[model samples]
Target chain A: MAAEAVLAEAGYAGFTIEQVARRAGAGKPTIYRWWSGKPALLIEIYARQPLDLSGTDTGSLEGDLVAALGRLLAFWRDTPAGEAFTALLVEAQHDHAALEMLRAFLAERSFPLAELFDRAARRGELATDFDLAAGLDLVSGYVWARLLTRRLEDDSRSLSSAARLIARGCLRR
Target chain B: MAAEAVLAEAGYAGFTIEQVARRAGAGKPTIYRWWSGKPALLIEIYARQPLDLSGTDTGSLEGDLVAALGRLLAFWRDTPAGEAFTALLVEAQHDHAALEMLRAFLAERSFPLAELFDRAARRGELATDFDLAAGLDLVSGYVWARLLTRRLEDDSRSLSSAARLIARGCLRR
Candidate 1:
C-alpha cells in the first residue's frame, strides 16, 4: 500500500526502496526479506490489484474479443492500478530485472483471454488453423499502441473496430 | 551527429542539452536557437535518417509489407540511429513536447505505407471499404509491439506472418 502510494505520488523515477521503507514504517531488511528489490516489490503490488479477467462468452469470438478489449480499456482508463502498470512498463525498459518481471506479469494476465480463443476454436468459430498467439499479439498490440501514444480515448469505437478486424481475420474460411 | 553519439553513449536518461552542446562544441544558446530542446533535436536527427520507404510491389500487398517491415527492422538493428529513436520514444513519456514530436514523426514515417495500402485497394486486392488508417495501426502496432518487447529476432518469420494476417483481414469480401 505504501509502495503504491509512493509510486503514485513520486512516479517511477522518484520511487526508491528507502522512501517506501520510510513510508511503510518498516526496516529496509524486512522489506528486502519479503521482496528482492524494487521490481519485485512493484510486482507484488501489481499482483494484488483486482483485475477482472472474467471474460464474457457472448456466443461468438467477435463478441468475446470486444468484451475482453473493452474491459482492458476500462481497466487502463478507470483505475490507479492501470497507471501503476504503465509506470512499471515504462520503468521496465530501463531495467532488465523489471523487464523480466513485467514479461511474466503480462503472460499471466493474458491467460484468460487465451482461453477465449481456445473456446472459439472448440466451437468451430475460428479458422481451421488460426495462429492463436499471433492473433493475441495483433489484438493486444493495437490496444497497447493506442495506449502508449495517448490516442486511447474513453470511447470503445477504436477497440470495437480493432476487434472486428481481428475477428474477420480469424474467422473460419 | 554529436547529439546522436551522445544519445547512443549516454542513453535517454543521461542525455542533456549541456552535454550535447559540449560534445558539439556549440554554445547552448546556439543549439537552442536551432532546436527548441533535446526532443526537437532528437526528432530532427531521426527525420534526417535515410529511411527507404520505397516498398517493393512484388505484385502483392503481403510482399510489400514484409519488405517494408524488414527494412524497418534492419534500420533499427544496424544503425545507432535506432538507439536514438528508442531513446526519444522512451523520453517522450515524461515530456509533453517530446510526445507531440513523436506523434508527428510517426505520422510522417507511416505515410508511404498508407500509400501502399491505397495502391492495394486500387488494384482490387483489398476491400473497397477497407479502413486504411485502422489497418495501418494494426500492422504497425504489431511490429512496434514486437520491437518494444524485444521479441523481434533477426529472422523475417514474424514480419511475414503479420503481413499475411493483415492481408487476409483486408481482403475484399
Candidate 2:
C-alpha cells in the first residue's frame, strides 16, 4: 500500500525503485525481489487495489445504473485509489507500452460488463439488436469525457441521469 | 492536396515536411511558412476535412443523434483523416501543451451539438437533468477506447448507439 501510494504521487517520469523502497520501509532488494522494474510495480499497484464495479441490479437497468454511478462517483471522488488509477491511466496515455497494458487491462476488466449487457439483452433488458460494444462505449466514454475535462467533480449527477435515459429504451414496451 | 494526403497517410510521428514537399512537388518553405510545424500542419488538414455533424432534426434525441453519427461514421470510414486525428489525440494525451490544445479544440469543435440535446431537453424530452459533460465523456471515451486499443476501424455506429442509450439513461434511472 505504501509503495502504491508513492507511485500515485510521483508519476513514471518521477517514479523510482529506491523511493518506493524508502517509503515502504523495505530494502531495495525487497522491492526488486518482487517487481522487475517500473511497469511491473505500476501493474502490481493497479491489481492490488479493489475496484468496485458493483450495481444494485434493481431488476431495472436504470436503477442498477444509478446505483452503480453513485458508487463510481463515490469511489472517484473520495479515494486515493481512484486518483491513483486515473493518474496511472493518464500516465499510460503518454507511453506506448503503458498504453498497451492499459488497453489490455481495460478490455479484460470490462469483459464481465459486456457479458452483463448480453445477458440483459437476452432477457429483454435491452434491445434485441442493440450494439453492446457501443452501449458500453457510451457509458464508459462519458466517464472518460468528464475526466479529461476535469469536470468530473461538478458532473457526477449526470452519470445517473445518463443511466436512466438509456435504461428506458431497454425496458419492455 | 498531395501534401495533405501524405500527412493523412503518414501521421504525425511518421510525417516530415520534406517528405510532403517531395511528394507534393512543393517547396518545403511554403509548408513551413504557412504552418509553423508538423502539428499545426496536421491540425490544418484535419480541420479542412471536418466531420459533418449536421443532419435533419429527427425530433427525438435518438433520431437526431443517428443522423449526426451517420455523418461522422461516413467521414471516419471513407477517409484517412480519422487515423491522423487518432494519432494526434493519443500523442496529445502525454503532452501538456498539446493536451490543452486538444481540450480547447474539443470545446470549440464538439460542443456545437448542445443544440441537439437542448432541443430535446427543451421539449421535456429527457427524463432527468442531462449531463452534457458525462454524455460527452461517453461519446469521446468510446473513440478513445478504440484508439487506445488500436481498433481504429470501429465504426461510428458505436457513437450512434451511445448517444441513443445515453439519452435513454440505461444505467442511472
Candidate 3:
C-alpha cells in the first residue's frame, strides 16, 4: 500500500525504499529485509493488481481475443499497474537482474492466454500447427506498443482488426 | 558520429550533451545548437542507420513480410540504432517532448511498410478491406516487443509464423 502510493505520487523516478519506508512509518532495513530491491517491490505491488478475464471467452478465437485485449488494455490504462509495469520495463533495460525478474514474471503470467488457446484447440478452431507462442507474441506486442506510446484508448476497430488477423492466421481451414 | 560513439560507450543512462561534447572535443553550446536535446540527437543517429529492404519483395505477402521482419531484427541487433531506440522509448515515458519526437520519427519512418503494402495491393495480394495501420501495428509491435525483451535473435520459425498470420488475415479471400 505504501509502495503503491509512493509510485503513484512520485512516479518511478522517485520510488526509493527510503521514501516508501517513510510513507509506511517503517524502517528502511525492514523494507529491505522483505524485498530485495526496487524491482522486487515494484513487482509485488504490480502483482496485487487484478487481471480479471472471467468473461472474455466468447466461443470464438477472434471474439475472445478482442474481449481479452480490450479488458487488458483497460486494466493497464485505469490502474497503477500500468505505471508499475512501464517502470519495471525501464528498469529491466538498465539492470540485468531486473530483466530476469521481468522475464520470469511474464512467463508465469501466461495462464490467461493459455486458457484461451486451450479452449480454441478443444473446439477444433485452431490450426493443427498453430504456434501458440507466436500468437501470444503478436497480441502482447501490439498491447505493449500501444501502452509504451501512450495510445491505450478504446480503439475497437484496430483491436478487431488485430484479432481477425490472428484468428484467421491461427484458425483451422 | 560522436553521438553514436557516445551512445555506444556510455549508453542512454550516461548519455549527456556535456559528455557528448567532451567526446567530440567540441563545446556543449555547439552541440545544443545543432541538436535540440538528447532525443533529437538520438533520433538523428537512429535515422542514419540503414533500414535497407532492397530485396524483400518476393512476390508474396508472406515472403515479403518474412524478409522484412528478418532484416529489421538483424538491423536492430547489429547496430547502435537499437540502443538509441530503446533509450528514446524510455525517455519518452519520462518526458513529453521526447514522446512527440518519437511519434514524429515513427510517422516519418513508415515509408518502408507503405512501399511494401502498395506493392502487395498492386499485385492483388492484399484484401481490398485490409486495414494497413492495423497490420503495421501488429508487425511493428512484434518487433518492438522482441527488441525490448532483448530477444532480437534470428528466429525464422516465429517470423514465418507471424508473417503467415498477417498474410492470411490480409489476403484477398
TM-score of chain A of each: 0.89, 0.76, 0.96
The best candidate in terms of DockQ: 3
Question: What digit string (tens of lDDT, one per residue) describes model 2 on residues A33-139?
Answer: 98765656776666666656654566666666666656655665555445455555644644677667767767776764675565566667776657676666666
| Cα lDDT of model 2 by residue, B60-129, tens digit | 8778776765565556556666655654564454456656666777777666467777777776776565
Candidate 3 ranges beyond 4 A from true positions: none
The candidate that wins on lDDT is 3
Clashes of each: 0, 22, 0
Candidates sorted by lDDT, best first: 3, 1, 2
For candidate 1, state the interface root-mean-square deviation in angstroms to 1 decimal. 1.8
In candidate 2, which residue ranges exceed 4 Å CA deviation?
A1-3, A16-40, A53-55, A87-99, A111-124, A154-156, B1-49, B54-67, B70-103, B115-137, B154-173
lDDT of 2: 0.62
Instruction: State the displacement of the C-alpha of residue A55, model 2, in Å, after optimal TM-score superposition.
Output: 6.6
If scored against the real structure, what TM-score would every candidate get?
0.92, 0.64, 0.97
- Model 3 residue B70 lDDT? 94
How far residue A6's Cα lies from its native spot in candidate 1, in Å, is 1.6
Better DockQ candidate (1, 2): 1
